[model samples]
Target: MNPGASYQTELAQKLQCFFSDQQQGLDIPPAQLYRIEGFIEAGLLAGFITELGLKQTLVDSAKQYLNVEVADFYQQDYRLILHMRMHEAPVYPSSNPPCPQS
Candidate 1:
């Protein structure tokens, strides 16, 4: 499958997982579940980085550049950064266990 379809499938699966507690009486409709799942995934990813990462100044700077609220979507745009090796080197230093590819 193409990237778009794969993303959609992954998103759907995430929604189902996030809402597995159908019995919890959440103020969420199953139809709007994808939005919640996406939010959870983004929040969890950000929390992981903040809680376990290298705590580097550059990363904090990068997050600001991207706007903290949606920083989770800011993968190092190698094309935009130009400094290739410099960019990749941060990958190892940025997280304790390494950043996950979502």
Candidate 2:
């Protein structure tokens, strides 16, 4: 697969596993649920979904499927940092010709 496709797949798998694990036995409040749902939706909009991955079908599917409500304690700043890391630009080696021999 292409590098972009591979990266997306890896991201989707990580997200799926993370959310699924979070859904184990947690009881989340409604307000926190809303925040969790928003975060998942943002991920979807940012192209984090796959054929069998997170989607916008219902109001609480993110909670039901990914269970991000567990992370509600994370502040906005922390979430932003995570988001930036996930979408960080790739670095490439400098292409300038090697300095001419003295």
Candidate 3:
């Protein structure tokens, strides 16, 4: 297994537990529970992304083409960089898609 995978999974689980405990202490109405859940899930996702350090890796790998040094790279918001990279990933069509034969 990848090292980052384990770290991300552990971090997400820990954050979820923390948020769950907070939810228990809150007296929010049923209608607001969904909002809390969404917030928790988003926090977990962002935390996971940060813990993975994929953005750092991407920056390190592109140092030459990007004309940026390691020290300078640290000055940027790598989390947002990773988010943009993920957003730009290709999306394949689902209908009649190619698949490996069983």
Model 2 residue 44 CA deviation (Å) reads 14
Clashing pairs in 1: none
Worst 10 residues of 1 by lDDT: 78-87
Looking at model 3, residue 15 earns an lDDT score of: 36
lDDT score, candidate 2, position 84: 12
Question: What are the lDDT scores of the predictions, listed in order?
Answer: 0.38, 0.44, 0.44
Q: What's model 3's lDDT at 61? A: 40
Instruction: Check candidate 2 and list the clashing pairs.
Output: none
Residue-level lDDT of model 3, residues 4-102, one tens digit each, is 467556544543443343334433344444554464355457554543354454454435323364325544753423211111346877888688889
Residue 60, candidate 1: Cα error in Å is: 37
Model 1 vs truth, CA RMSD: 19.4
Q: Assess candidate 1 and give its lDDT.
A: 0.38
Query: Using lDDT as the measure, what is the rank order of every candidate, best first?
Result: 2, 3, 1
For all predicted structures, in order, the TM-scores are 0.24, 0.32, 0.28
Q: Which whole-number lDDT from 0 to 100 does residue 88 have in model 1? A: 21
In the order shown, the candidates' Cα RMSDs to the true structure are 19.4, 15.9, 16.5
When 1 and 3 are scored with lDDT, the better candidate is 3
Query: lDDT per residue, candidate 2, 38-90, as tens digits?
Result: 65555556665432243322213344564354233222123321211122346
Highest TM-score against the true fold, candidate? 2
